[model samples]
Target: MKPEPVILPCGDSALSVELGAVIDETLNGRVLALDALVTAESPPGVIETIPTYRSLFVVYDPVVADYATLAAWFLDRANRALTPPKPGRNWQFPVCYGAEHGIDLPFIASRTGLSEAEVVRRHAAGLYRVYMMGFLPGFTYLGGLDAAISVPRRDDPRLTSPTGTISIGGIQTGIQCLASPTGWHLIGRTPARTYDPNRDPVFFLEPGDTVRFIAVSPDEFTALERRAAAGERVAEAGNP
Candidate 1:
């Protein structure tokens, strides 16, 4: 039998429904399922729902809904069998690997005991799931990394990582939406603007989306970056 979720209050206005302690897809599925249920029901005073790897953080108006009442409400539904939400969009992003674009490619290859080409090949071949978005705007945390290339985070994190950085840390891989400090081992970069405030949809990727990386040359990366900067949607949407 599945374990019951632990409902813990976050101050007086928000609560966290922890489904599991690990980063398993089943647990994440439940989180998303609960998010869908709560959103569909539109519970009174519920302000927002944020689904993470294995928990759902629900923010509500404390005046309209007390913590005890809301906790009981989430506990009942979280323990019940839930229908998983439909899969989100599939996206194919063009990436430029090795050399300056992916400065840590050699280090990652050495650590993983794989050739540089093999590392890039394995990374590009695997289909990744967008588990959640956090840390920064449109910074997507992805699941489903190729185990052969998986490695621990960098011992020394860089002060700044460029936007469009594709990296792997621990058992996961992710796409960096903006230039920021990161501990993940950089393997490549994609020109697609996952987050663009000026664009119609500010965020391109969302939780539950599947992503594929396509290797591109430096010239192609430059061309794509230009197009992306000009407000063009550079990433191609794939069929579900």
Candidate 2:
């Protein structure tokens, strides 16, 4: 299908809504607005919102709710959230592309027939919008990648890349929160750790937020690594 809003039963305790194929900042705003409206008129069981590239997965408490009742409420809010999503802030996250940080940078440059510098410049040229967070705890699927640098996934997925590995997958750019196997082309690594199971909220960076990438040097990544190890925090590009 082209892309449309879809709601599905999620194990009786939760409900999932696929918001459709949204790729632009404006569309992202509309999705978030519709999400907010639904939350505002939240039915008894509604719990949280999960926004993605083209969908929003609405999670709710199943103990007190059922799909039929909540789906009706959702459909109602979807009708209203059509106005637009209110603008949110843009975030910048620093990345040290290539080498140990980005294992696939060289391979990608070889395939794309461009200098590594040009690749990095294109990757960092524009701010990306947080399309959604899923697949992992704090991982974010964002838009705004320049198609010129877009490439296919790696044939072999790594056992895990360190948390904060910045990578390109198809037309999207993503930040890794925890080490996990992935097929995306690795371009850089970030100093930011957006997920912490021990932390009160556990996750930061919700959908509809904007993200920017600032390329950093290898030495800086080493310093940031040290700071991270010492329990001292590195001043990453984005705001909490």
Candidate 3:
């Protein structure tokens, strides 16, 4: 049975519509469907909407739309758009897994009882689903990790991980676009600029997108970075 959504106040002008308590794809689908519905409907005074793992935060102008009225409208639209999400675009990112780039690969392999090469192969082979984008702009929360390679987060978080770092923690994997502190084990690095403020869209990946990590050599990494810096689209899209 589908769970009843919980509408909660979020700050003065935003309300969060939680579709489910768990972080599952089905729940995320419902959340995203309602997000699409809200965007298409474009209710008066609505400013923007942010979709997370299983919730949608609707921001509106309080002067034009009251909280009680907005909350009721959100719930009404959510109930009407309960259809499953359609498959999103499939994107392939080139990743270079080496000592300099993936500093935590060896440790992750040792902890997971797998060889470093095997770990890389398994991680790259995954057809990961983008559950949501958070923590940072273009930082994707990816699902569909191979359980055999799954490992716990580091006891001590790294002070700063480089941009394009691909890592895994618990049962989830993710791609970080900015230098930030992290506990996830870094297994590879991509040259694709997932977040570029100067770009047309400003974000390369989105929630509901599918990702495939393609292993590349150090030489290829340098070439790709140059192209990406020159504003070339590093990631290619296909049918998911």
* Per-candidate clashes, comma-separated: 0, 5, 0
Candidate scoring better on lDDT of 2 and 3: 3
Best candidate (score: lDDT)? 1
Q: How far is candidate 1 from the true structure (C-alpha RMSD, Å)?
A: 1.1
Point to the candidate with the largest TM-score. Answer: 1
| Superposed Cα deviation of residue 232, candidate 1 (Å) | 1.5
Error of 1 at 31 (Å): 0.8
> lDDT of each structure?
0.91, 0.75, 0.88
Model 1 regions more than 4 Å off: none
True lDDT of residue 31, candidate 2:
70
Candidate 1 versus the native: TM-score? 0.97
TM-score for all models, in order of appearance: 0.97, 0.86, 0.96
Candidate 2: which pairs clash? Answer: 19-55, 19-56, 20-54, 29-85, 30-85
**Residue 92 error, candidate 2, Å:** 1.9
Q: What C-alpha lDDT does candidate 1 achieve relative to the native structure?
A: 0.91
Off by over 4 Å in 2: 1-4, 21-26, 197-202, 229-240
